[model samples]
Target chain A: MIKLSELHLGILAALGGIVLLFASANFAPLPGQAYGAGTMPRLIGWCAILLGCFMVATSLKHLPEMAKPHLADWVRKPRLAFAALACLAVIVFYILFAETLGFLPTSFLGLLALMLVLRTKWPTAILASLATTLAVYYAFSRLLMVPLPRTEFLSFLG
Target chain B: MLIFEQAAALVFDPYVLGVILASAIFGMLVGAIPGLTATMATALLVPMTFFMDPVPAIAAIVTATAMAIFAGDIPAALLRMPGTPSSAAYVDDAYKMTQSGRGDEALGAALVFSAIGGLFGSIVLMTLAPALAEVALRFSSEEYFWLVLLGLSCAVFVTPSSPTRGLISLLFGLFVATIGMENPSGEPRFSFGNLELMAGIQFIPAMIGLFAISEILRTVTATIPRQKIPRSDGHGIFKTQWKNLKKYPVQTVRGNITGTALGILPGAGADIAAWISYAISKRFSKTPEKFGTGHVEGLVEAGASNNSAVSGAWIPALVFGIPGDSITAIVIGVLYIKGINPGPTIFINDPQTVYAIFMVFILANLIMLPLGWLAIRGARPMLSIPPSTLMPMILIFCIVGAFAIANSTAGIVMMLIFGIIGFFMEENDIPIAPAILGMVLGPMLEQNFITSMIKADGDIFRFFERPIAGGLGVFTILIWTLPLVMLLLRRRKQARLAT
Candidate 1:
């Protein structure tokens, strides 16, 4: 991930506010009233624009330092960066496959993979993954009746 | 008397008691771990609470937060690593006491004083909230608009950060709240044609992402070496507390007052309360030189203050539906989800439930005593759990918790997106509390604003026509402009000096 300086963030905020203002411009007002759904968004957009300008003005004094954007420290370290990406990957993996392959397999695989990436031993990772997957399965699926995706093979377990 | 009995019956049920016990353990576990906050604990508990009845659901949260705040002291005393931000205030005093073989006393002061302070705040909540609700019941849309604005203003201004950054966060949250078709005109503002987006951003999933997932990312990517947990003599966890209580009665009471007061203020919570109480203790102490070097004086005061602040934060949340801190911000969301709309009307409409909540507060504080002691005794094993192992487990919980909220992949997707946003916000020194506050209060602010505007036929000055609304509006505007005024005055003074 990139570490954005205040100037960059301010610029982004200003652009975002401008986009909001244009998007809300077409929202029809309530019948016979001066405002509608667009009113609050417009107000927020204006505030964001003003705030962005204020931030840019205040940050300009440190322009030499503030204009430069860099990578976060974690992004510079391969191992840690991998771990961070692996965490996001696990979530994405779960989202894509939880419904298809079921919560048990997807969660177990995701947890074990992330654990292994984080340097947990294979045995500990496997056992912890299996145990946590089952525990969560029962806690949410059975006790709480959340109807989490289930595998035919794990039907009896459910 | 009947209402009190009904409230007691609601609280003492086997199920309610069981939920309290379970959440007490859960709170202790989460709070005793470094980097997991009481707010995180509350966020994690929300999904489970979503399954239970309103009373037990609320009981679980009430018990968990009270326990989490106290449990934070355990790691602070033993490892010089505060388990939560609230414990950061007196970490030096607590750790020095441990190093000097007074660890038991330090932990005991934290546990006992925390419970005492919680009880004091609960009593204050019981006595004060209903009385204030009477006044709140008379408020109208104009009054609500200013009140919500005042709360949002406090969230941006009172927090220890650049107000500009806080306002940016607040604006982002308000914008997020505008995504659904829940607005007055029933028009989809930013749904982008997605079915789920039309329902608005899911509060629980967003919160889980903001607090839990971002915390996991930060913890996993950090380069700080883990410190060895210090061995402490855990015997007599409560033995010295009595002596300390007697010795520092004034400090204890003062801490309770300060914490409760701060807690009642919008956006300020236990963390700030602890820091302020510790400062006050030192400011008034004759032996201030001993503050950072194994002194228990500051611990007694700040420990009490943090827990008291937890209970004090509920004041505005219960009475006005304005959250006093991030925890209550989440609670307000839960209450609305449960169809128990908070505000002064709740006292009149659901008096029994209101009293039951009051009862839960007292019960939660009392139960913190035994649970806090057990946490202190078992701190070594709990602290030994590696982040590499724990982070994955927590991630799975966050994933499932987010998914379970609405039983859709969209919730998990939202969590992931917000997780990255939260991480970026923290990296940029933007405070998350105001954002959470803004998200929770955004719709209400807009609804009240539009209602007042329509009622006044776009006459903006009529917002101040009602005396109460006028007072609140003026106060909110003053809070907004005071800092700018101060900056201008200081600049003028500087110019004169330079000339």
Candidate 2:
């Protein structure tokens, strides 16, 4: 876990730098109109800088009250962490495969993989995963008219 | 009379009826699923609605969402799991009601009261929105600027524990809003050398990240060891009493009215509406202690208030083209994409469309009553599903939902970012609401402020000089100061008493 003081200091420094970057950019001539792209960013940059300063001050003065991040706890629960990572992997695979494998097969694969990871019984997992995949496929395709990718494999099956 | 006839025609349409029924059922299913919020459900549906008639689309979407919100109570009451944040308040009470074999009664009361509240909210919206818009038409950009400021200020209470952090979050959101090309000019700002950034952060993906993925991460982190409470095969699973409803009519009406009024207020959404109504009811109750311990009145009030919020949310969406909550924001986006302008001029330009949407509300609420009844009757069977099964199913929804939005691997990546950030934030009791409010309102504030500043020729004082802007500034100041004043007064009183 990062110390609150250190976190505050780092966050503020980063915010200040980001603000300065915006301020250094060529600014618009008018307040609302854009002579350049930098105007609104500058305003937001200043607000961030000010808030960062306040956060730094508050953290310094009330260190006990400052919040500490709990990355360690997450690290301790390796299974939970793995589950979360598995979730991300499943989603990434779904998106990648949606175009190639198409919606149905890909969705079913993603669900089945996730179900296994979640420790669902194999029989129920296969059944429910298939039902959900088919239901969503029908809803999106026939009812909502969303154009899901049609792979050659899927077309051949049809 | 013309509007009435138009509305009546909408009511009589069979396709319109079908749309409402289907949408509401879908919404309920969406809401009942853990981590699948009304906003996510609405966003997923919003784009599809583009192909449909605006009237039926709006009706179906609204019906689905409203029922979905109520359906959240189902999980809360039965499983001690809140499907939506708005249902969070009554979760304890409703769950307790279930444990005591009154779960069916609690669900019944919530369903009936929510129906009543939705009707009341629509009434308030029908009366108040047009009048407000008529008044709002008089507002120049100066007033518009103030109104936005006032809205941001009201949002301050949305995360009361950390006001400074809230303001910082808002500023960050505003900064994100600036990333895209300038609205007034074609010039790009904050693109940081990326074309995708030039379009700015898409609200839907950002929302999906914040609400859906954030929740999944939080749940994974705080994995509660499932308690094995004996499953009661209680018989009165769908029993609700008109007698009980009549007994608590005052509570239901009060909750509905308060929820609607709060809903109409910019920046106040269903979560606040439910909280505020619950508090008011508790305050006025003769036995306040009865709250949080399965009080039927508390359940009735919370349900009604959240229901009213759905209607109340529409006032801003329909009249001003501003969404009061995430769901309404998606609806406003839908209207924008559909080329249906929703401002004061919209009423005059498309009265029939406006009436059609309103008529949908009337029909949606009516249909929700029967649909709600059937769903509640069928809920106990749903409770039989083991958490193990649910965890996988929800995980699938979360995965597909995150991916389907932009088809970007970046969205899934962003979901991971927000989920981690959100889990940590919740762990520290730092509150997730401010971060979300920051994400939601940040860009709007920037755009309005930049636009106002441009109009004022860099004169910062001009922001304070306009009547509406000045008024909002003063109100913001008052809101910011009054809490400090109360704290100081309390400290002083404590000192004097000790002396």
Candidate 3:
């Protein structure tokens, strides 16, 4: 992840406020009323704009230090960076594949991959992943009736 | 008397007791572990609570949070690492006590005083919330608008950080709340034609992402090395508490009073309460010089405080639907999910449930003695579980928990997006509590503001026409302006000094 400086955050907030103000400009008001849905958004936008300006103004005194965006320490470590990306990938993978591949397979694979990346031993990782996958499957699907995705391959287990 | 029986029957059932026991254990584990907070435990428990009835659901949360706050002292004393932020205030004292082989005394004081404080807060909540709700019952939209604004203002200005950053976080949350067509005009604001977006962000998923997933990301990518847990000579966890109680009667009462007072304030929770109570204990003590070097005075005071604040936070949440802390912010979300609309009317309509919750507070604190002692005895193995193995398991839970909210992938996607946003916010030193509070209160703020506007025919001055509304409005405005006045005064004084 990138570590943005105060100035950058302020600038981004200012831009965001501007965009909000313009986007909500077209919202129609309530019947026979001067304000509508747009009123709250517009208020938030103005507040954001003022806050961003204040932040920017306060940050100007240390302009040189405030302008530089630095990378967090973990971003420089290859192992830790991989661990972070691997965590995100597991979630993204589950989103894309859970419906087709079923919760059991998708969760097991994701958990296994993440555990391995985090340097857990292979045996413990596989066992823990499988156990967790099944436990979550039963808890959510059977107990809570959450309707977690299922496939023919895991139908027997269910 | 009949209502008390009804509430007792509601709380003492087999299912509710079962739920309470399970959540008690869960809260202890989460609170005893470093980096896993009481709020995170509540966020994770929401999914399971989704499957429960109202009483059991609330019982789970109430019990879990109480246990978590006390269990946090375990790691704080044994490892010099607070299991939760609430325990950070007296960590030095607790750890030093352990170093001096007074670990039992330290843990015992924490357990005994924490229960005392919790009971004190619960009594206050029972007596105070109903009375306040009576007044809240007569409030109009104009008054509600000002009240909600006051709560938000307190969230920003009361935070111990840059108000600009807190305001930025709050604005971001309000903007998120405006994503759907839940407004008075019924116009789609930022949905961009997607059905899920039109429904607005799922509060559960967003909460899980913000509190749980962001924590996972930070833990996984952290560079800090884990510390070794110190050896503890544990025995007679309760033997020494009677003497300590007798010795520090004033500190115990003061802690409870200070904690409950701070807890009633919006956005100040157990963590802040503990810090403030510890400071007060030092300020008022004769031996203030012995504060940081294993002094039990500060520990007794702060330990009582953090737990009491847990119960204190429920006051505003139950009475006015304004959360007193982040934990109650999550509780408010859970309440809404259970189809229990929080506010003054809840007292009239669901008096049994309200009383049951009060009962749960007392039960949770009383049971903390046994549960807290067990956690202390078994702390070593629990802390030894490497984060490498635990983070992945937690992530899986987060993924499935998000997915279970609406049985859709859209919830998962929302969790992912908000997780990254929460991580970024924390990295920038922006507080997450105000954002959570904003998300919870934004719709209420908008609805009341618009309702008052319509009722008053767009006349701004009419907002102050009602006496309660006028006083509240003026008070809210004063809170916002007072800080600026102080800032200007200080700056002018600095200039004069320079001259």
Per-structure clash totals for the candidates:
0, 5, 0
Clashing pairs in 3: none
Which of candidates 2 and 3 is the stronger one according to TM-score? 2
**Candidate 1 residue-wise lDDT at A136:** 83
Candidate 2 residue-wise lDDT, B1-499, digit = tens? 8877987787568887777778888888877764456876787787668788778778868888888888888877876556666776576688888877777788887787888888888877777786753444455566556555554554444343466655655564555566667544556665777776777676545544555555555545445654444454454434455866777888888888778866775556787677666756665788777777878887788799998988988887788887767788888877877789888788889888887777777777777788887887777775566655655565555554555556555555556566555554445444454445445555555556667767787787888886766886777677668778998999999999999
Chain A accuracy as TM-score for every candidate: 0.95, 0.77, 0.95
Quality class of the docking in candidate 3, CAPRI style: medium
Per-residue lDDT of B96-177 in model 3, one digit per residue for the tens? Answer: 8887778888989998999999999999999987564355456789887986787677567534357788888889889999
The best candidate by lDDT is 1
Candidate maximizing DockQ: 3
Per-prediction TM-score to the true structure, in the order listed:
0.75, 0.75, 0.74
Better of 1 and 2 by lDDT: 1
Model 1 agreement with the true structure over B184-274: per-residue lDDT tens digits: 9999878899999999998768876876677788878986665444655555778888899899999999999888876876666787688
The lDDT, on a scale of 0 to 1, for candidate 3 is: 0.83
User: What do the candidate models score in CA lDDT, each in turn?
Assistant: 0.84, 0.68, 0.83
Alpha-carbon DockQ of candidate 1: 0.62
B170, model 2: CA deviation in Å? 3.8
Regions of candidate 2 where Cα sits further than 4 Å from its true position:
A1-49, A59-71, A156-158, B1-10, B13-16, B30-113, B124-130, B164-171, B182-187, B227-359, B376-388, B406-410, B455-471, B495-499
In candidate 1, which residue pairs clash?
none
